[model samples]
Target: MRAALFQMTSGVDPAVNAAAIVDAIGRAKAGGADMLFTPEMAGCLDRDRTRAAATLRSEADDPVLAAVRDAAAKAGLWVHIGSLPLKDERADGRWANRSFLIDDRGAIRARYDKIHLFDVDLASDESWRESSVYGPGEQVVAADTPWGRMGFSICYDMRFPDLYRALTNAGATILLAPAAFTVPTGQAHWHVLLRARAIEAGCFMIATAQVGLHEDGRTTYGHSLVVDPWGAVLLDMGDVGGLAFADLDMGQVADVRGRVPAITNRRDIPAQVTLA
Candidate 1:
């Protein structure tokens, strides 16, 4: 299966971002891509809490999702709108960082909210308290598609290897980590972490990311990538707004697993603690 990953520098307006998404969909279709994946916060990006709150729309009312869904239908392509910052109905004031998997017919096949919030304190006063604004997701997700059984995750989830193991155990052959990662962390650990996940799970790992500076003054380190089961980087779309393409060799999953079989070799051990 052929896929296209969108590296975006989204702004505060959902409408404008939606238009750009539609255009990218068209380009992906033209490029003979069967599936298209986009970066996190493709719907909108704003640093100011007040402005971001005002701009967010409910999933039912989001124009960005509606536009991309329609575009996918028209082109007969599978689409993953990596993550959208939406108004969460269940939570009173907090929002939802949600990801979607759309079929060729424009139907939503699966939905995964970002379970891990990016609450971290970086150097030089660069910090974020994502959990304060967005409620965390409770469920893990894996979806069946024409290509393979796809596992879904967002930005901060990359830091957690256990989640990827769970998904792989649940029959995931391809893992997606769509992100809006900060420059410092992305530069330091992005490639290493993603490749490690792929190597461990024996699954292809794909990460579409947000890049460049936004209107909100936040900058993302964008290097959208596709890693093979052998921990090889197939494609890397650098810090720019564009598309990264790659073809999946599904047989590699079983081939690599047959050799290593790490996922199948399991042992449970109790932790031993000695009083000091």
Candidate 2:
């Protein structure tokens, strides 16, 4: 199976963002991709989370989604339309960071809400308390796909390795981390963390990311990648806004499992603390 990872740069406009997504899908289809994955905050990446609330759309009336679903049908590919804004119950009209898996026939197979809220403080006086803007997901998701059971996660969730292990433990072979990682922390920890997840899970790790600047003047780390079960990078489109392509063999999963066997090597153990 072949997968396309879209490294996109999204701002505030829905129409413009959707058009860019259409173009990325075209490129991926032309490259013979069987599956395509876009990044987190897929439609619009705004600086003001409060203003972003006004743009959130329901699956029922989103024209952008309709067009993308149609494109998925036309290309006969499973499209992971990473994360979008779904209106929430908050009085301020917050949104849930959600992802949908649109099948080859244009059916919405599954939806995964981002479980981890990105509430962090960086050195730029740039701090995000995602909980103030969005609600956390109720559960971790591992969805059924044609290629394999694909585990779904958004940006900040990558910081937690146990979640990936749980997903892989539940029969997931393809792990997708759609991120709009910040330039600073991403430069320091992004690749190292992603590669570590693949090596630990013995699975195919696909990451579609946001590149360049956003409406809020925030730049993202956009080295989107596709790593194999053996921890080999199948393709890496470093800091580019385009499709990162790779042909994935389902058999290699078992091959890597046979070699490393980390899954079976897992053992329950007690925790230790270093603080004194």
For each candidate, C-alpha RMSD in Å?
Answer: 1.4, 2.2
Clashing pairs in 2: none
- Candidate 2 lDDT, tens digit per residue, 52-141? 667767767776688889888887778998888777433455577888899988899988888899999999787988887788887888
Candidate 1 residue-wise lDDT, 27-127, digit = tens: 99999999999999998988788988888888899889899999999999999999999885454668888999999989999999999998888895898
C-alpha local distance difference test of each model: 0.92, 0.85
Checking candidate 1 for backbone clashes, the offending pairs are none
As a whole number from 0 to 100, the lDDT of residue 152 in candidate 2 is 90
> Which candidate has the top score in TM-score?
1
The C-alpha stretches of model 1 lying farther than 4 A from their native spots are 269-276
* Candidate 2 local distance difference test against the native: 0.85
Off by over 4 Å in 2: 89-93, 270-276
